[model samples]
Structures are given as structure tokens and as C-alpha cells.
Target: MNKLIFLLFFAVTSCTTFSRYSPHNKMESCVEGYYCIVNDSLHLKYETLGGFYFANNLKEYRKIKVKNKPKFKNIIFYGKSNILDTDYYLILNNEIYPKNFYFKETVINNKKITIALNSNTNGTYNKDFILNFRLPK
Candidate 1:
């Protein structure tokens, strides 16, 4: 009985007391200031190379393991790419989601853009949050 109780306690604490995002960034060869997560609080690190894009459309790819339940305001994404003023799609779980899917606001300046993530308004906490952007030509 004591052993079972200890195991249950360990499971519950492990899940609740820690973040779901990974602490390690996996994209080792990303072009500097191009495809990466900028915020420090989100604690998201790519577990895989995520995905690749065609030469025509340079997609930013990231497959981060969900280590913690993210705070709505803390989820910020800063990106720099060629398609600045064009529409962008956030591809999650092999589906196309809007840029504002989990965004509270987005500010674009030149080739840089900052996206502030919102609460669970449009997306949910899953095993992994895939960052695959579909930018227009």
C-alpha cells in the first residue's frame, strides 16, 4: 500500500508541478535570427527538426515537446523572414491554423514580427506544439 501511494504521488507531482515544454533547443542549424523561438519564459525547445519548406516558401519549422502549461501572456514568438506583410498560417498537428489562432496581438515591423500568444482561445495543450508557418509568396 505504501509503495502504491508513493508511486501515485510521484506521478501527480511530476505532471502538475512542472512545465510540459522541453528545456533543450533541437534546431542546431537554424539561420541566425531566422527560425527560432525568442521568448525565454515559454521554455519551448525543438525536439525534432520539425519540418522543411520548399525554396519558394521558406517555412519556419519547430516540433517542441510540451513541457509545461504555458501562461497566455508568456507565449511570445518573434520571427524574421522574407514574407513580412503577407498572411501566415500556424500549422499544428498537420492542420492549418490562423496566425491569430493563439495570439492576443501581433506586431510586424519590416522583416520582424512579434506574436503574443493568447489563452486557450483557439488552441489546446497537446503532447507537442508544432511550429510550422505557411507564408505566402
Candidate 2:
């Protein structure tokens, strides 16, 4: 009985299996700025190169993990990219999200854009956040 209880305790204590998301500014061998993303806090360093473009498995909230329960996911995405250039473009449609959260290039255009998210991560939501600005005409 003691051995069984020990095993159960180990399993419960090791249940930090939640997803993570973090974005940083980086350049892809070019002078232009690009978003460097990291997913899964438990991922090995070898698997973090080039970063990810779309990460929709982030755990926005904290919760206890129970046996056989659904996994926690996190979400963090980089800016848009152009085929001809490595620089990423992002129209800050949501001022709530920090403009310096990651690398993003602003264009002189006026069209509004949005990125829709469809995920099953618990407590994780893709809300409508808009950030609109324009350059000198």
C-alpha cells in the first residue's frame, strides 16, 4: 500500500505538463526584424530553432491537472511574412497587445485585418483586439 501511494504522489506532483508561449524580437540572418517564438516550456533547446509561426496551444490560465484530464494548451503567433523578404508585417489591430511584444513591421496602409483563432485549450481565448495607426500621408 505504501508503494502504491508513493507512485500516485509522484504522478500527481509531476503534473506540470502545461503548454507555454513567449515571443521575442529577432532577425533571420537579415537586418529586418522578425518574431522569435517559443512554445511548450518543456521543449528541449534543440527543438526551438527557427521558432513557430502559429502557436495556438497556450494555457492562458492556471489549473490543477488531474489524471486522464485534458491537456493544457497555450497560444502565441508571430507577425505576417512576405515571400520576397524575411521581415514580418503586423498591423497592430489590438492595442491591448503590446506593440513591442514581438517583432512587427508597420505599413503605411489603412486596411484593417484580423486573425481568427480556433482552439480547444481550456480558458484560452482568441479575443478581438484591435490596434490601428497610420503613417504620414
Task: Specify the highest-lDDT model's number.
Answer: 1
Query: Which regions of candidate 2 are displaced past 4 Å?
Result: 20-126, 130-137
Model 2: per-residue Cα lDDT over 93-114, one tens digit each: 4333333233223322342222
Minimum summed lDDT over a 10-residue window in model 1 is located at: 54-63
Q: How many residue pairs clash in each candidate?
A: 8, 13
Q: In model 1, where do residues sit more than 4 Å from their true spots?
A: 14-25, 29-32, 36-116, 119-137
Best by TM-score: 1
TM-score of 1: 0.25
Global local distance difference test of model 2: 0.27
Candidate 1 residue lDDT tens string, 1-137: 99999999999765521122222223343443334432233333222122333111111223221232322221122222222221222211122234443432222232122232322322332212333332211
Error of 2 at 97 (Å): 23
